[model samples]
Target: MSAPTATAPVGQTDTDASAPRRPRRKLLFIGIVVAVLLAGAASYVLVLGPDAAADEAVPVVEEGAVIEVGTLTTNLAGTPAQYARVGVALVLSADADQSEVTARFPLVKDAAIAEIGRHAAASLQGEEGLEPLRRGLTERIQAVYPDGEVVRIALTELLVQ
Candidate 1:
């Protein structure tokens, strides 16, 4: 029935308009703080140079000179029917005497095989046993080359069958 009232009925105000602006202000402040923190880090690195302690703590050592002593297959001490074949590799220093180490390869192989033959299957299964074996091999190899050419010895391939 009646003709419509053409005007707004009333007392509502635009209160929510400023509510959305408050959140945008908070976000802008947070972004500025983050940017400042990142800029500070960049400037620190650029002005003071790289952190020497971090650089010294973990100096990446390059594998310079390397030698692969051939694989050795020998029966273990106590465990019969179980044989171990270890492929050995040695990392040498840049100043290492390659000729001297090459000349003593036989002794190194013999020492490694004999040391490996002393341990049983159980003793050589995990790190506990592997550590001593590695130490033994290192000592034996280093004994042959007192110049300390051999930096590290790795059993690249180890299989017990």
Candidate 2:
């Protein structure tokens, strides 16, 4: 005959099987808690983080300081005695010599006037005409100084009549 198998008594459970299940249940609970925490953290970052950051205005960074070139009234190229009144400023590069620029301010103004004098009165009347004028002024002012000394030319005011 075959040997009889071992069996637990009635109303009793196996200790080994039950012991392993307790640790598994605890681990499952801990894993669920960790998942919930991560979800909460992600939601907070996605929803509320940008609003807190939006309160401050971002500042614009310019390459260097601006030197006012004052205003120049010059005769336009067209006939009928047309004239243009232009106010401009020079933005110096970071490494430029301020003293030299200040000493030669008159030459900077002269360069701007010469550029403006080349354009016709009708050409400087509208916004479309202003861009070319600005580019021309920048190039003209750069010619007055060494390369890279003048970073940009800012035209503050322009009136052609």
Give the top-scoring candidate (lDDT).
2
Cα RMSD of all models vs. native, in order, equals: 10.3, 10.3
Model 2: clashing residue pairs?
A: none
| Total colliding residue pairs, candidate 2 | 0
Stretches of candidate 2 exceeding 4 Å from the true structure: 1-62
User: Whole-model Cα lDDT per candidate?
Assistant: 0.81, 0.84
Give TM-scores for every candidate, taking all chains together and pairing residue i with residue i. 0.58, 0.59
**Model 2: worst 10 consecutive residues (lDDT sum):** 53-62
Question: Per-residue lDDT tens digits of candidate 2, residues 68-131?
Answer: 8898999999795899889998898877888888888888888887899899988886779999
Q: What tens digits encode model 1's per-residue C-alpha lDDT throughout 68-128?
A: 9989999988857888998887888767878877888998898888888887878888788
lDDT of 1 at 57: 83
Model 1: how far residue 98 lies from native, Å? 1.6
Q: Which ten residues in a row have the lowest lDDT in candidate 1?
A: 9-18
